[model samples]
Target: MKRRSLILPVMLFALLALVPLLATLGPRSFILAITTRIVILALAALSLDLLIGYGAMISFGHAAFLGLGAYSVAILSSHGINNAFAHIGCALAVSLVFALITGAISLRTKGVYFIMITLAFGQMLFFLGTSLAAYGGDDGLTLAQRSLVFGAPVLKNDVTLYYVCFAALLGAYLLCRAIVASRFGRVLRGIRDNPVRMQAIGFAPFRYQLTAYVLAGMIAAVAGVLLANQAEFVSPAYATWQRSGELIFVVVLGGLGSLHGAIIGAAAFSLLAELLSHYTEHWAMIFGPILILVVLFVRGGLTGLLGGGR
Candidate 1:
């Protein structure tokens, strides 16, 4: 990548690293809490960017993986499996299976059919979650405590948790950056633009696209693990269509195709929503127009506004 491309992500991470210090100036807990949520969601958004931006697979059921990750943590913790490694392992395994199966079926279709199938799969998971009465079902489940780190309550400290999540976000960003620059990423993008042409050159577009889909799902599941730890709760609402839509909005708001744009977009969307909700309960009404204006006028979302072309 060019030095110019590194500039924005570097600055973004530097500011994020300073956030705990900045929290001392204001509502410390509130600042740490909200920013942590932003980081986690940004991770999720980043994964979606891998699909939508590069793979051109508009997955409407993306939040299903998020919900799956959160539930993995919640359900395991409830069963006395509080180990962080176990939670992560279970989440990844579940997400991998779900993504592989769904991607195989979804990739066989195109355009609106693909979108609707993803949506259908997401709703199927949502209803399944609500049916899990043993895990609180529609009511949601609260964690007894955060996942243990080698039998220690290391993540219980707010600041420690914040840095852990920040590190995960940074790591996920780097992983995605590497993937996008790799030969596999190139094949995926080629498939996105012209699958037939790619096939003519001996590349199986289905396999590449399906692999990318599975990878994106697994990454988003990790975010879901962090989210469960952050919120200390899990609910079926996490997999709802509305939540999936918001992830798409976050990607578009940040500028599609650019990994760093997802981070900037998540920050903008979360912070803007936080600011708006305090003044009015009807914030979505006002926020809707703002997003519409950006979609209509802004060429590439907030990242574009910052002079970073997608």
Candidate 2:
């Protein structure tokens, strides 16, 4: 990787590491809460970057994995399976199965077809969540408690939870950085630029695309797990198409194909929403125009602006 590329992630993580300490100067609970949420969403956005940015696979139903992960925690906890590992395992297993089934079929198409199919799958899960009346249905479900670590309330502390989430974000960034720098990542990029040319060179685009899709889904699902734990609630709204759109917006806002860009975009999006909403309920009206301005004028998104172009 270029030394310039390392600059952003290094600075970003270093700043994130100081958040807990910084919180001591203000409303610590609120600070930790919002930051934890941003970190989790950033992880989700990073996974989407792997697909839309690197693999050129645009998915409109990526939020389904988020819903799956959240629901895994809710359903399992309700059934007396309060183990954190169990919830994570369930999320991964479910996300893997869903991604494999959906990706296999979605990879056969291109352009808008891929987008629509993913949206359809996401809506399917959303409707499924609404239909689960036993789990509170459209009203959503609240957890009696957070997941325990080794039968202890390790996550009960706000600061502890924040650090755990921060660690996950850091680890995920490294993992994705490794993947993007590997030979397989090069193949995905080649396929993104020209699938026909990649095929001519003896690479099967389908397998590579499908693999990327599944990996993205699983990673997003993990984010969902953290989100559920963070909010202590689960609802069908988690898988809504609007949420998926936000993820896309985040990746684009950060700059495509740049991992750390996702984190920057997520933080900007969340902080802007938080700040704007405090001033008026019509914050989205303002948010929409801001996104348009960024899309139109930001060249390569925030990362490009900061890094002097990708």
Candidate 3:
């Protein structure tokens, strides 16, 4: 219970940190860039936590949703449909379609099989993206300009874009928190703890799982759209298995099922990567082992290590 108290403080710290990032730093654009990436990834981490922690669905192919979102924005904007709402709608629609159809099949299995099937489907999308030679085959498609909001360029200002991503992160976290506390969430949690018992109670586990899957996919698409806007680009790399792994790692590192934990984990993970890469060219060589050890020794991930508060 005491661990739960850490949630508020951690969130406050992350929020407050942005002030200095936006203010004190010279050429603060770089810092804003870092903050934007962290916020966007934080949203993605929140989406992953919803299904994995609450719904007990482990998917290694989640990055496919990110690709879908990125492409939705890039492709539309490429053809001059630059409205933010249009791109956002396209992203969510594409992600929902894929998640629903795939969840129906993948949720039929359990555990390792579920993971494998999701990974396969995700690869299918990755390859499909690679084949889009017109947009950008092995390479990525770059947006000619930032997306239009109403009429002006809402995403043109780097700082404004950072705040937009931050707001989305906050919204996703709140949405996930509400979901986890709802009547539906209680059933989903029960399904995770004991699907057999949930079935005994006459609940259809697959329906709940699929619902959560689609919701998660939508959330991921939100992150993906923000990512495309930030980079002003979209690529097949967005759907790579390694990218999916990093997302899963974010959830586990944060302490599964804890919304605050996911945010903390994402911030820490992104900041660590940014910092470590600056000090060394082969940062992954050092970072990977550290993560391996954390997974090995700190079974609770960040929350477990910190004795996670609320």
If ranked by lDDT, best first, what sequence of candidates would result?
1, 2, 3
Q: Rate the local accuracy (lDDT) of all candidates.
A: 0.94, 0.93, 0.86
* Candidate 1, 21-55: lDDT as tens digits: 99999999999999999999999999999999999
Which is the better candidate, 1 or 3, if ranked by lDDT? 1
lDDT score for candidate 2 against the true structure: 0.93
Q: Which 10-residue window in model 3 sums to the lowest lDDT? A: 16-25
The C-alpha stretches of model 1 lying farther than 4 A from their native spots are none
CA RMSD per model (angstroms): 0.8, 0.9, 2.0
Candidate 3 lDDT: 0.86
Q: Judge candidate 1 at residue 79 and give its lDDT.
A: 97
Question: TM-scores of the models, in the given order?
Answer: 0.99, 0.98, 0.94
lDDT of 2 by residue, 26-59 (tens): 9989999999999999999999999999999999
